[model samples]
Target: MYRSEFYVFDQDKPVPVIIRNYTQDDFDELIQIQSECFPPPFSSELWWNKEQLSNHVMRFPEGAICIEVDGILAGSLTGLCVDFDPNHMEHTWEEITDHGYIKNHNPSGDTLYIVDISVRPRFRKFGLGKLIMQAMYHVVIQKKLVRLLGGGRMPGYHKVADTLTPQQYLNKVIKGDLKDPVITFLLRCGRVQIGIVENYLEDEESCNYAALMEWKNPFNRT
Candidate 1:
């Protein structure tokens, strides 16, 4: 479904942001934006092959929501519906996203699993990331889903990797003792820290660890 979410600005020009379903034409720009958003080791360009993206588009057509600002690709958030165990150990991106088409995609499942969210380097601080989350939240509610799930890489984790454990570092962010721009932003936006997922990505920033996080839909109950 197409949704005209909001607008941003560039040099006094209003850039309309239209949140809508993923389309075939969005592939190339998406790959480009992804490449620019991340650096080596964790850069999606290294892992997300074109074939994988083709699979994603085919499997969850509506799951891959994209943001276009001023008629240009700016950001995106892709996800899947899954029936998972609360006690199940956190999984890697490769595990949750089995080559872009998750195996445990239960259409009737209660969880909305966010696979990835990215914003181009140029659009970094425009609050587009939060808008992506809002789009996912909208999807979860529209689908009657109860819980939202995802893993967050702590770019700030590398600075304290030698000093604090992943969870310990997460706690500092949670307690507001230390600020992790990404994790803390999500926290402030209502996402709760679930736990730590080891080997979540190849990035050394988190010591290969990611924080398992969730944002429950207040209007929907499990």
Candidate 2:
């Protein structure tokens, strides 16, 4: 178990937060959290099912982590090891994450590819998502992986889709002229934008585009 303490904005004091590997018992809660995180436009059909969650913990327990505040399951971050080629990083979420089943997990892979990360809406003020991401970074270091990579959603894009192209919007976000809920948060967590990935997922807000981001393992000797 990976443990830490954090201060919740509305709480009186710091709460005990624990990051632990995904287990069979967390299936229902995990699905519930997914539903709350990605409601209507995000596609309920894409939510975590028994099969995918089972494969995640079974195939790579270390790559799947959940965070609890006090005692409530507040969020989760899931990933899979992959032999990623930085030069060819144009795959869709389904292709890279094996449709969230992680059936393509490579034990000897150089990168830890993040599939999903979400924090409960009520707990979003506590910086839990960043903490969960830090847990993934620890996993990357433990496994001696080269980096952590993921296709991040641009939920703030569609609001300006009529006025800005995806790339243009991304540029503004990077330059701090604009802030995207997902991309801005990821950027603050030490990830850098690689490029804009088209058709990365089916989210109307993003116009079906994703921001490819990566956090290099500075300590990696390879």
Candidate 3:
């Protein structure tokens, strides 16, 4: 189900990266970049699992896209085109889930759920993230997908509440420590915070909040 394709580089000029689908061959590099980008990113084993991988495969060739600078993978954006109803379905069964609860609770149709999008630290603050978002917006429009949604929870730094415990879960809620830059960047891209999932991310903490956001279909032709 999970697949990836590589655009090989023959010369030294900046590599032209077109947003496209992913292939298994991209795993080793994906994992490395992910680890460096997020505090607790997905492990190699997690990326290789059949169920997890299958969800990423696009029926169309350009299901996902990666940015390569000088033939080196720098960032990627993974998304899904589906009519999701978070209300009728459940999240427990899937190895990895996407916006199911949000859709069921809110009931949106033909949504383009952004599963994962990250750029390596070395490439941060260079406007690549916004570029990726713009590319994604165009792709969704080209394919006629309706809605777009993605967010990262930013728990304020040095302000950890005693109610929360265990660094894992706490990490998700406490975004100020290592995640401030990414959260700030998301805000600048025009995403608006919608809700906070209490204790949604931490593994040990008794409670925390997840900051949810939504970016209106920028590609919508009014």
Best candidate according to lDDT:
2
The local distance difference test score of model 2 is 0.90
In candidate 1, what are the lDDT values of residues 1-222, reduced to their tens digit?
A: 747667777668877888887778788888887778766656454634567667667777668888877777888888888876779856787887774656556688888888878788788657788877877887887888888888888989989888998889999999889998679878865799878989888876667888878988889755
lDDT of 3 by residue, 96-203 (tens): 234321222212246665666878887664556776776667666666665566535454432455543334433453453444444566676766555444444452
Higher-ranked by lDDT: 1 or 3: 1
- Please identify model 3 stretches exceeding 4 Å from their true place: 1-19, 39-51, 58-63, 82-109, 157-179, 203-207, 218-222
lDDT (C-alpha, whole model) for all candidates? 0.79, 0.90, 0.52
lDDT of 3: 0.52
Clashing residue pairs in candidate 2, if any?
Answer: none
Q: Write the per-residue lDDT of candidate 2 for residues 75-94, one digit (tens) a residue.
A: 99999999988788788999
Best to worst by TM-score, what's the order? Answer: 2, 1, 3
Question: TM-scores for all candidates?
Answer: 0.89, 0.94, 0.62
Local lDDT at 203 for model 3: 26
